[model samples]
Target: MILLKCFMVIFVGQFLDVTSVYNPMLTYNIRFNKLRFLPNVTGNYTIFQQKDKQYVSGYIQRPTTDEVNKYQLPVFHRCNPEGLNCEYFQSWTLTDLCTLLKDKNQIWSKWYGAFDPPILCPINQYTYVFRNSTGEVNIFLKWYPDVLNYQWKITQKLYSGDFYIGSYYNPMLTYVVRIVKITSYPNITWNYSVDTYKGKYYVNGNTSITTDKLIDKVVGVFERCAPEGINCEYFQSWTLTDICPKLLDKNQIWSSWYGRSFDPPVVCPINKIHYQIRNGTFDLDPIIKIYTDATNYYWKLTQKMYAGNTLVGSYKIETVFLGLSRIDDEGGVVSTDPSGLAYSPERSRL
Candidate 1:
């Protein structure tokens, strides 16, 4: 085998100064949402206070005998107050999850340790549970304290080896941690849905579909605009045919709505005689769900069925990314905090 040496590069971008009144993102807290793609790994951790000092104590278990030497790469994202205009705040490649504990170079390193099945370089297959761990948030802010004032979403992923195109390594772990300045979780606040017969996207005010290809044309994109809601910038869009298979992932994450109590067409068959969406634009499930922490941003999605070149019927939906809500206590649709809802990694508790 030919030996090859590769260099890792760090690219730092411009950061909006937190001192500016527009981005005073001070005072933040962290939350983790645990989601397992594979069954071999499972764990949970939380931040606790002891003797005026805060620390994290928890465990990450490996039920199988598989071990990995690769480290986790974390990418931090900072968004605007409206949860729009997100940019990378900072990032780090953690060679050891216990670096906050064993790295003597860190100031508080002496105060932390891995108690059960210690975590050192080249992580072992044994389950890991640590006490007197580094203060989750403190160690984070020590590098960029000014960042605490804004909203942040950090995603970390680990693999068995170098992350490349077709090298082929199973995903070992993924961590998604959200840091916010406020307590309430961000969710959509939808106003209304277009009517079946009188909606704007309806062709010549017709409500029935003359074509069997109900999904002939589809457009989905995220849109942002000026405070006045004018002069908007439409991001790139995606074209999809049958949105049926995409529903599986959405059902897992947004279980509250796409749960067992809910069901849609299994196969969006187009080779039919006549198709009619009796409700027009209502009750149509979205392709993407719960990825955004932005309650203020909206997605414009349109789907249309056609007969030759004539437009028969169509549906246009305008909703915030997090707006595809769940049922509330009184049977009304409502969007709430993402704490217990999102399919994310609950990695931090500050």
Candidate 2:
């Protein structure tokens, strides 16, 4: 294997810093989007310089793994020219090989065949992009992906100059921008549904997946945004609508609807506590009787009523209250009494 001598050039301010030791006699092309870019190699081939001192430099035709698979190509290597026996091309990816060529200006030539493409991406290509001071430009090239770094080894094809073919080991292709660094979770927000039934309002909290105390973080981020003397207004509501209607309905309808009767029409306080009567019995069946009075105040018809958390008596009151008298005093009221009325949860409390 004869190593080609290539000179490095650096351009500054649209001017060459040094004259070319060799002419722009370099061209390289690669086959891409196919199984393999070159023919399979069965035996070793010789690669040597024109003389012991005289040199030739050109890009090797490296192929992508996908291209090798598509073309059914075999792998080949540019062995040492002196021995031409040991194989040295089996370990490198197309991308890694390309980096070594450009950085160190070393070249490896393929004698009879080209490198095989790996199985990950079964395609063939013949072009790759290169960057000089002016920027990236496409040249005829071949490359393979590096399994370790997801990069490619590349070889340039001689499109215009003396076809001096060789290959070299290089780092894979890379970009500062193409590489993304995700430091934190993504920013996302959600919308929820709201519903109201009767006087109760309901809202669906964050039921989907995640919840964050972003509001607390916001206060910290914008500590100066709040006024010096006033508290932060983030937690207060502007409307009292949720509870007002329900409160009014309970007050007007539930406060006075249930009660036992007295001859003088005994008045009860609006806030007396009520209890549920579970097993109270009545003298008259189906009279909607309930026990009420100072000792047993409850609605006449309600099976359950509040008696300071204790039921009044073992007996249930008749549903009907005599027009202006007690049941024991009026010989018990009949179920047909016009005053047997039903009340709501709020009103029946005594």
Candidate 3:
């Protein structure tokens, strides 16, 4: 039996800027609320899969006296897009996470190349940051794999059982990692931030990208979801067959336009990395007739770079057709239900 875990409860297009589909990225957000505990907690997380990948990052202040063995475990909860109807998902001990860090990646000195903590779970007076610089992120951490084409959510319970933060308290730590979907006004360009290096993640700003390995393949996705990227219902996922190829896919939902309705993805995976691109921008202008039908919905377009099964980097553009409507693959058109936040398609109209 294939059991799934919990998810996020995003209020479609609430306060996020992202896009996706072929590059299945379940929009998410991180909420580190202040609570009565020995130490302060904060986190930065990413729940997206380029060639299918998930990542977690954040920091916990130096505790007065904390040990990994003193806590229960980090429990993850799942929920709906609107941040409702939650349930228990899974758990991971701080020690186990540490072991993976020490034994596997040997990243004790550099957790994601920016933050570092003692491999032995150093419990002295010191602040440290930890996150998956390289590895598999729990898919159900936000949404189930099967639901990639639909709107979804889940809950996460951050409790320090005297281990992570070294103070078992009543109100557990709540680490909310919300990956927001981009839905800017139609045709507005959005820049792609963040860069990933040798398992280390970086929100690349003016810095240059560290890797330019021969890109194997790239998945370009154009997905339609609610304003806040909820209940993503339509998916137009395609792939670049060579080092650099045009944006074309069998899921030509953009076929309506005589082929000139939207901007094409920039050819990528060149011999050299272009730092100049850090300031460049992209947007969604898919002129297909299907898009004309759903002018009321927000669309997210993403292009993910990969080397083998590894994700080298990615490009994202989030925006919505100012007046785009949504279409339901199952019902032809979205039902006029105010309570309905997304138009979930039974299947991708691929």
Candidate 1 vs. true structure, TM-score:
0.47
- The reply for model 2, stretches above 4 Å from the true place, is 1-110, 113-169, 172-350
Instruction: Write candidate 1's Cα lDDT for 246-343 as tens digits.
Output: 54443333222223322232234443432222222212222212232233333444444343454545544433222223444554334433433232
Please provide, for model 3 over 21-48, each residue's C-alpha lDDT reduced to its tens digit, 9 standing for 90 to 100. Answer: 2233443322222222222333333433
User: TM-scores, in order shown?
Assistant: 0.47, 0.14, 0.27
lDDT of 2 by residue, 1-350 (tens): 11121111101011122222222353212211111111211122222223222211222234332333221111223222121122224322343333332342222322111233221232234433221111111211223221111112222221112221222221111100000010112222212222222221222222111222211101001111111112322221122123224333422212122222111211232222222222111221111111011011112211221234332222111121122112233433223112232111111211
- State the TM-score for model 2: 0.14
lDDT of 1 at 130: 63
| Model 1 stretches with alpha carbons more than 4 Å out | 1-42, 61-72, 77-88, 92-115, 121-127, 136-142, 145-153, 160-209, 214-219, 225-231, 241-268, 271-296, 304-314, 321-350
Q: Rank the candidates by TM-score, best first.
A: 1, 3, 2
> Against the true structure, whose TM-score is highest?
1
What Cα-based lDDT does every candidate model obtain? 0.36, 0.21, 0.36
2 versus 3: better lDDT goes to = 3
Global Cα lDDT for candidate 1: 0.36
| Pick by TM-score: 1 or 3, better one | 1
Q: Which RMSD does model 2 reach against the true structure?
A: 37.8
